[model samples]
Every structure is written in structure tokens, then in C-alpha cells.
Target: MAEEKDAAEALVTDLQKKITDAFDVFDHESNKTVDVREIGTIIRSLGCCPTEGELHEMLAEMEEEEPTGYIRFDKFLPTMTKVLLERRYRPISDDIILRAFEVLDENKKGYLTRDELVKYMTEEGEPFTQEEMEEMISAAVDPDKNIVPYKDYAAMMVIDD
Candidate 1:
């Protein structure tokens, strides 16, 4: 158990050093941090391709101590660790589907009624046709409960990429 604990600590320390070194290359201004706008560059430097929306979502996940939208090495470490882990384990579409479910499940009931799903699919941005909406609900909705749990929704939308 002690050996396992020591190994984990060593791994974390090594990752932190690599991350801080990457940040240093871009922290040339001596601010000891990277602005949120440079997030894409930093992510790419770290060998990840993240959309602008994803970058904003990451910043949103940071704690209150990360004010000014500037990310220091300490703040960047945990956030990037989470982001990398999620990307490695989760399908990209899962995040999109989860966000959509959150928007439609306004009551925070953890499930969406058929009507809520329809409303979401028909909304202004990229409106889904009636047929597509019906297909989506039919594929994911629970017949007994008349709702789609977020897990079911994500499963229906996930593409093995």
C-alpha cells in the first residue's frame, strides 16, 4: 500500500512538472499565468484539440480562486488533469448530449419528458425535423416512465470514435 501511494505521488509530481514547464513557455510575459484566450494554444501544446466552447466550459469548472480568467500552474494542473481524463475515457458526443439534456431537463429531475425533448430538438439552433425528433425520443425514451434519463440519452447519441 505504501509503494502504491508513493508511485501515485510520483506520477502526479511528474505530470505537474511537465504541465508547469509547458505553461512556462507561454508565460513569457512574467505574469506567472496564461490568459483564458490562450487556452486553445496551450491545449494544443499539450496535444489536445479543444473547441472554443470546450475551453470556456473548462474555465467555468475552475474554482473561485481562479479569478481574472488567468490560469496559474496550480489551477491549470487539476483542470487540465480532469479535461484530459474525461477526453480519454468519454466519447465526445457524451458531453454534447449531457449539455442538451441539462438544458431540456430544466426542473433538474434527471430525466426529460417527451415534450421537453421535442421542444429542445425544435429549438432555433439546428432545429430537428419532426421525424428526427420522433426517432430520437423513440430510441431513448423509457416507455414505462415516459422520460429519457441522461444516461440513456448519452448512450443513444454516443458515436464510437
Candidate 2:
């Protein structure tokens, strides 16, 4: 138990060190801080590819206490750690998702209409609950196309190793 705790602490320390190193590359002046705007780059340097909205949300959380113009190592480390760990949770791969979607696309159109997706999502297999269907549709559907472009949707969900 102690060993596990030690290992977790060690990993956190390692992450902190990496975060500091990445921040330093942009810090330039040895202030142990960087402009709040640089937070996205610093997090990406540590290999967390957060979406722009996600970055904005994180920045909002940081400013919850009060607006800040710069981020210190201490503040950045925890946020970066959380982002890294979250990124570690792998998304469903494109190939697997493509195969699954292919099964849904009997007409070979490379897409699924909203109605088809709704039917399959709500009535087929284990089925997605109403909320799940809504969320999936919001993420997977193309507003203009009014269809789930399965290939593009699958690609969007794939995360590089």
C-alpha cells in the first residue's frame, strides 16, 4: 500500500517536473510563470490535446477565484496533471467505430441520416438512453448535412497513440 502511494507520488512529481520544463520553454524570463494565453500550448507540449472549448473551460475554472493574467508553476501543474490523466483514457478507435457504423449503413452512403441514427441509437442493441442519444447526436451529427457522416465522425473520435 505504501509502495503504491509512493509510486503515485513519484508519478505526480515526474508530471510536475515535465510541466515545469514545458512551461520554462515559454517562460523565457525565469518568472516561473507564463501568460494565461500560453496555457494551451504548455498543456499540448505535455501531450494533452484539449479542444479549444475545453481549454476555455479550463481557463474559466482557473479564473473562478479571480481573473489572473499569468499562471505559476504551482497552478499549472495540477491543471496539466488533470488534463494528462484525462487524455490517457483512450477513445474508441476509428476502425472499430467505422465497422460498427458500417453495419448501420446498409445503403453504403458513408453516412447515417438523423432518423436512422435515432432509430438505431434508441431501439437497437443495448440502446442509448434519450440523454445519451441526444449527446451522441450533438457530437456526431453534422448540422448542415443533417446526417452522421460516419467516416468523419469516426475520425473525430479517434485519438492518436
Candidate 3:
């Protein structure tokens, strides 16, 4: 008889693994804690570049203690896992996807302009160069040169892959 793993336990395990991997990749010297600057680089390595202020704020929230500025293995693990689990559990219904598209297409023209992308992603301080935004929209737009539909957006998030 195998015992079922509780949600908290599972989340803790997953978060710890991710934190360990991040530490290994970012900490070339294998120091337990990465310097504040390196934390920004690590977050960028995960694809979204965080501004300095954003990095500081995020780290401040993540760190429970002040001394070493460390996200202790125990403390870091559970938080990350909870976030991932919530994301995984979120029901991306068709209505939700349609609403997201509508939100993104602020002009209601059914297509996302480069300006809109910049404006949207900028809330996170992730400024995309005009060229980058253009490329992203090019890839995201559907055939017939029409804007990406809700179905397409939802398909991008398929968890079972």
C-alpha cells in the first residue's frame, strides 16, 4: 500500500528541486546563496528578464531572513512549489482564453500590435524591443494573417503535451 503524497509535500519537493537546479546553474562557485545581481540573471535565464528593482522586490519577498540574503532551501522550496501548483491547477477554460485575447487586443481590432505587446509585458518591467515584439506577434498570429484565436492561445498551454 503506497501512501498518497500530500499536496504540500509534493510542492515542497518540486520547489526544492527547482531551487537546487537554479543554485547549481547560477552559483559557479557553489556558494549556497547567489548574489543579488545573479538572481536577476537567473530569472532572465528562465526567459523573462526582470529589472533591477523588480529583482530586489522579488528577492525581498522570497527571503525570510536578512543576514546572508539567502533563500534557505526549506523556505524557498515550498513557495515555488505552491506557485507552480496553482498555475498547474488553474482551469484555462475557453472563456478565460477568449477574455485574455480580448484584453491583449486592446484596440479590439482582433490583432495585437507591437505597441500593445510592449505595453502589456511592460507591467512586469520586461521591456521588449520593437523588433522583439514584432517577431513575437508574427509568430503568435494565426493563419490568414488573422489574430490568434482563443483556441490557439489555450492550446499553447496544454499541460499534458
Instruction: Give the total clashing residue pairs for model 1.
Output: 0
Name the lDDT of candidate 1: 0.71
User: Residue-wise lDDT of candidate 3 within 1-161, one digit each (tens)?
Assistant: 13356766765676567657875676666656565556655554433333546556667767766657455544544544554555432334556666776877667875564445556756644576666667666766564755555456665643341
Runs with alpha carbons beyond 4 Å of true place in candidate 3: 5-15, 37-58, 64-75, 78-95, 103-109, 119-154, 157-161
Q: List ranges where model 1 is wrong by over 4 Å.
A: 63-69, 85-161
Pairs of colliding residues, candidate 3: none
Model 2 C-alpha lDDT per residue in residues 54-142, reported as the tens digit of each score: 77787776653766688777677787787765664234668999999999899999999999999997787666668768989999889
lDDT of 1 by residue, 72-102 (tens): 6667778877665455324466778788778
Each prediction's TM-score versus the true structure: 0.46, 0.52, 0.47
Which of candidates 2 and 3 is the stronger one according to lDDT? 2
Give the candidate number with the greatest lDDT: 2
Per-candidate Cα lDDT values, in order, are 0.71, 0.79, 0.57
Q: Between the candidate structures 1 and 2, which one is better when assessed by TM-score?
A: 2
Cα lDDT for residue 158, candidate 2: 67
